[model samples]
Target: MKTDLKLNVLSVGNTSTGSRSLPSQFAEPIRPDLVKRAVEAIQGNTRQQHGSKKEAGQRHSAKLSRRRRDYKTSYGHGISRVPRKILTKRGTHFSWVGAVAPGCVGGRRAHPPKPIKIWAKKINDTERRKAIRSALAATLVKTLVAQRGHHVPPQYPFLLENKFEAIAKTRDVIEALEKLGFNDELNRSSEKILHAGRARRRGRGTRRKKGPLFVVSNTCSLIHAVQNIPGVDVVPVHQLNVSLLAPGAHIGRLTLFTEGAIERLEKEKLFMQEYKNLHPPVPPAPQSPASHSKLQNPSNTQKQSQPTQQKTQQPSALQPQKKVSPTKAPSTKSKPASQMTLTQLTK
Candidate 1:
């Protein structure tokens, strides 16, 4: 079945100039599992490697002896066997405290984060490509978009005319967005709030709602114009990824595509292979004996019919049939793997 999915291309004035068919990527199956994995993999790759210093909290020269009657001996001291630091001594009695243990003060952590530890999660190339296609498909889904807390326009899957890329001023970009019925969304994203808890002190002082993403064919003046707007991001179609489209492993983001970007997607055939598999070609039906006889000559008909009979009989003889054991019955319970959803599997 062919999908006649199309998006209306709006001009700068929010007037519908024309409609164009959506690319095959938009028709890809919504595999939330792949999308989440791709997003996580991208995030993991960007994480900075961090670890505690090797000699941190372990430079103390203090030592304790376990041998009895030995100087600074911790054994038979009426205290637990542990490394101790001596403070003051009088005769055979000495004042000391435990050290170098995780439970003790100024001690090394039991399992500190190591810089050598791998943080990046590997994803198959095909899976990553499928994920990008899934994320792109989610953008066209109204339910998914709304679930992501985006204020969408009445006409979903918004597409813009090529002229939008010519916008050079931030004011013009805001005005164009307002005229396109995005005033509510613009206002929503503009309301920034102070981050809760320690996040504010950790450099993420303010947080704002994610607004519509502008996807263009190439670098243009509009990129500068829209970037200044709160929560608005301008990304070229070639650089599109699951993380950008489905932030925080959540599927669906309000996206605006330029006419040129849509054309480029079709021309490049990105994610076309995955899309083709979603709709496989149906196999031809088997021909009946009457129809088969009509297609063949009278003399050859007997020969063809004999082979067809033999072919059907051969499968029964060649194929091994399993003996049903009366003692055992097939399990009705579904396998955990088969029962798991994409989100659960990804997690």
Candidate 2:
């Protein structure tokens, strides 16, 4: 069965060229549970393992014995039976301070983090793939995109022509986005706020809102051009994951897709290979009688299409062809075949 969803294909000028059917993955149900699990797994893998050293805060020479008459004993002392370090003392009488305990100063932590602790959360391969599809589907929902706090164009799931990948200039990319009705979104993402509390002190000093994500079929100059733009990200279709699509376990992100990316997604059967095997893509509809006639009468159609076909039929005169010339062999001595050029060997 054909999907009811049809995304408008936008030209380089931000004009709608036509429409294309979305991939089956975009039709998957939004499963927030799977999305959150997948995102947590991804984030978990990136967590840096950290822990206090084994000797940290426990290197002091402090020692105390509760046994009566033992050396450095605290017996008969008013203080509790805790380890104590000597400060200053008189003969047979000592002034001690608690040490090597959680309540004491410069003491080891009660429950310090351990390096051996496993930080990564495990997820099934199928569940991770499903989460990616769910997140991808969420991007197409206007309400979900809005709920995620993204300022989006009126048309959700923005689709751009394949030509959009060739964009090499940041200014041109910005202009195209503005024309596509994302001026407000661009402005919104541009605003940066200082991170609150310790996070600011630690490396993440500022944070910016995530803007529209551009998903293309392959790497291109556009990736470099958009890197400097605040909050804007360019990712290849194959590299798409749940974390990028649904940051903080929240579904829905403003996403822009190139026509080539859509084609790749379907052809590769990404994230929905199992479902695609059950239902193959529908074949193109039969051409109309009038359209069939136009196809049959190629002579008439060729005359009308001559101008567009000329570039392919003839090579450009501006590009000069290179010429190869025969070379004369040296009379002194014959060189090895490997050392001689083809032209020199011919002589």
Candidate 3:
């Protein structure tokens, strides 16, 4: 079945036993947008919420008096508006030290994180599934896997046989991985880094490099074998998620699939939407008669006919409107010289 497929099933001894065709999910187009969204949503959903204690900084009774003789009051005292409690008193005077206010020695924070605040993000089901498919396709691309900093072998993106899943010893698993050309990859991930100076102070001291992923059909001995390996992960096919597929929201992680896992993926159709649950087609609305449709609403029919009726009722251009005759004004100074009489002109 490997006719056009470039994938091969590798035995525990690192020999190609047969070829296997990739599922349609592997042919999905790579979409970084969807992948990033899904990964971020997962990260946000996994975030733990924390906040300051309820009684923090409010444990002390720092109330002060406003009387003239009271030293606790800031009435005559040349002190700031900060609330202070009398720690030590002597006769008529008292020691009023600042506390219970912001900027004081031990005061409540202006704003603190609230444990009730939601930190999770949500994405559509179809979008999340598409993102997973995209990530799966990204795994097969040699350029992407290499770009993700994995030590890719000559036969990159090959699947392991079901027999490989039976090995329970970590040493045997390492030997098999080394034979499959992952020795350098394993060595690279094994080395740890101790952050220096400020980075260490920020709790980032020890770090391990991310390594290749192993995907299998179910919980098997392989899962426990790789548990001791740094950055090496083995997840069952059904439990696959965006975070596992593309760690840190970056596309493409070196992934090894077991032959049984791929077959299970095809059988279960993981992450793909099911068609049986879709809504049944609604029966087509019965066609109504043209006359009845036009008369469905009297208001609409009136509104449409009003304009056409006005156009038809308008008089034709052949009959022109009569012009209003202008009335003559009293003669006096308004009359022109030619129209005025000879005696009137002399006057």
Q: Considering every candidate listed, which one attains the maximal TM-score?
A: 2
Q: Which ten residues in a row have the lowest lDDT in candidate 3?
A: 303-312
Superior by TM-score: candidate 1 or candidate 2: 2
TM-score per candidate, chains pooled: 0.74, 0.75, 0.70
Ranking by lDDT: 2, 3, 1
Tens-place lDDT per residue, model 3, 164-200, is 7898999999999999999999998999999888988
* Regions of candidate 1 where Cα sits further than 4 Å from its true position: 274-347
| Predictions: Cα RMSD each | 23.2, 24.8, 11.7
Model 1 lDDT per residue over 1-347, tens place: 22479888899998888888887778888999888889889999999899999887677655878898797687876788767777789997888877777788998888999999888889987888889888898899998898889888888776899999999999999998889989989999999789779898899989888899999999999998987899899998877888888888898899999999988888777655533343479999999988888787576545544433343444477689888878878888765897889987887
Each model's lDDT comes to: 0.85, 0.87, 0.86
- Per-model clash counts, in order, read 0, 0, 0
Candidate 2 structure quality by residue, lDDT tens digits, 1-77: 22678989989787889999987788889899999999999999999999999888788888778888887788887
TM-score winner between 1 and 3, please give it.
Answer: 1
Candidate 3, residue 173: how far the Cα is off, in Å: 0.8
> Which is the winner by lDDT between candidate 2 and candidate 3?
2
